[model samples]
Target: MDSIINSRNRCIFGCSLSRLLSSLDGVIQNELARREPSLYQWYSSNQNPLVVRTFVNTFENDRRFNSATAICSEGKPMDTSESDLSLLVLGLFCLAAITKLGSAKVSCQQFFSMVPDIIGRFMDMLLEFVPISKAYTLTKDIGLQREFLCNFGPRAAVPKFANDHGLEISFWIDLVQKQLLRALDREKIWSRLTTSETIEVLEKDLAIFGFFIALGRSTQVYLSSKSHTDSNDSINSIVRCDRCEF
Candidate 1:
């Protein structure tokens, strides 16, 4: 009896997760279609496992953008703002994962797991712009403390990117809220709570999801905006760099 009940619970949770993932996939596809037709083209054309792996590696150490800057007429590196660069890289990382993993295969856990890696990679790339003396300070200052990370980390810039493009991401908040409610109901846990208590519980849980959702709402906004003005074509070059070559 216990085994049967556990199995049922797993099935219910899995169904909810699958539904949420499908919704996320749709969001990603529509955004790619509307803003990054070039990236969409790349995503469609690529299918080899090796190529996918290489692209994933690009998420870590890819430096075509760094190289592109050296060739500019000024003969100096392009001065990318920390916020702008982080937004660009974060956008690429999220979109690349979607393309590589396929939307349905990307679990919610996997999606959130990228936050620390993104922050680490962003900080590594950011170090190039700052003095050696400040590197220690930077690490300690921005070190993965939850409050600062959620509010001021690379992912946080995603909200600003969304706002700049006149995009709405409140759908995510609504979807997450519903998912939380459904989970509580499925567990028969809501009976313990009064209406106010339910609201309080949900608000506490949803706060973290909301922070990340703001970041996810429009992950690749920077890529689209940058593609237009960067004559070096940094965005396309990064996406199609030799690292991703077949």
Candidate 2:
């Protein structure tokens, strides 16, 4: 009886996810029809080469870049092993979206503006199953989480936004990383860590390195063209360190 109930529940959950994807597809289709009539016509007729490439790129980034990091963050300090399953569902959804609707034919400015909304929706759906506390733990990695929050958090007109959100996010990430590093060092768990465990740690560290690279790139693109020359030089210096080679 318990097994039957569990199977039924799983079926219901799958149906619900299917419906949600359909709804999102409809929304995107309607939005595109209203916003880009020419592109919508091209997509409807199945005649555009760039449409397929753009769709693939968007889906790939959503899956590889955003979804992977989100999954990793979902797995931190909580019983979130099951949350990893969301990546599969999200990938399927992206595949379906690309197959049906293709990418939005919009300006970069419009696309950038739309991205946060899309990300927020994705995060909301993920949080529905995973819970915020667990996700927060995963996202609070010292290097990436702080930079992410600084870029995205809400702004209050009275007080500065970066100070408010950035500081809190930074503190949490720092606290978690310090605790982890201290535990690892004190326990001398490196000796005990299996090859897989060591690899996981190395991957997390690489994620941090990737976050720094992204930050430098964003700074170079938006701030000063020369900004990344110094940043790359700094990264090269650090990467040359004996301990950093993993």
Candidate 3:
């Protein structure tokens, strides 16, 4: 039947992914054993093997679309969203690696370097679209940072080698805040943005925000399900004014 054929294809696809992860994990384990014997033991014995199960359980879960929209540069528009999503994914894997591997800058420097840039740039792009001025300013204050991190950040460089090259999180945060104010006050960029422009930008901002929101919630649930405890508020809410237009 048609359904059976589709199911078989899905199974094959999942199996391929599992095999790939298994192969990569094996390589990782071998390297860890040589470089970090103690870590290798924990990875092999304590942690469960990374086996992927099914991918599409529902019709909605099916990923059949060939192409999708991507946010491009406002000045130089591109057909696709480009490298941002890839960078974001790599960044997240690093964070997960840190959580699982029990190491900070030394162990997860790649993640630390990359995640900040992604957050900084994405947040910067997102604030431009906020429908409310007050909400936009507050979010920009906290979210946009890491001007240098986007440039001088160690690209795939090991922590052992490139530990000194990356920017401190606090430093980038301070730098971004200062930059935001200057661009707002001195540069006078607000006149360029109108209420209509803000509304137009809202969908893109919400798309990126919603994706992270979902990821955050799912991560929280996964962590909490492992151990019950009160959750810290990772995301702060800024209520948009219904009366005001950006």
TM-score of each: 0.20, 0.27, 0.22
Expressed as tens digits, the lDDT of each residue in 1-246 for candidate 2 is 544543443454456456545565565567788988676676656745577678656755764445433534535532233433345345334433433342443323333344334433434444445534444444443123442344334421122325354453334334434444564466444453344357778676566555545644543453234222324443333322212233
Sort order, TM-score high to low: 2, 3, 1
Question: RMSD in angstroms, all models?
Answer: 24.8, 17.7, 22.6
Model 1 C-alpha lDDT per residue in residues 26-134, reported as the tens digit of each score: 6556667898767666664664456757855664454534442232336543333443343333443443444456435654554444444444444454334453224
Best by TM-score: 2
Can you rank all candidates by lDDT, best first? 2, 1, 3
Number of the top-ranking candidate, with lDDT as the measure: 2
lDDT of 2 at 172: 38
* Cα RMSD, model 3: 22.6
What is candidate 3's local distance difference test score? 0.37
What's the C-alpha lDDT at position 201 in model 1?
79
Better of 1 and 2 by lDDT: 2
Candidate 3 or 1, higher TM-score: 3
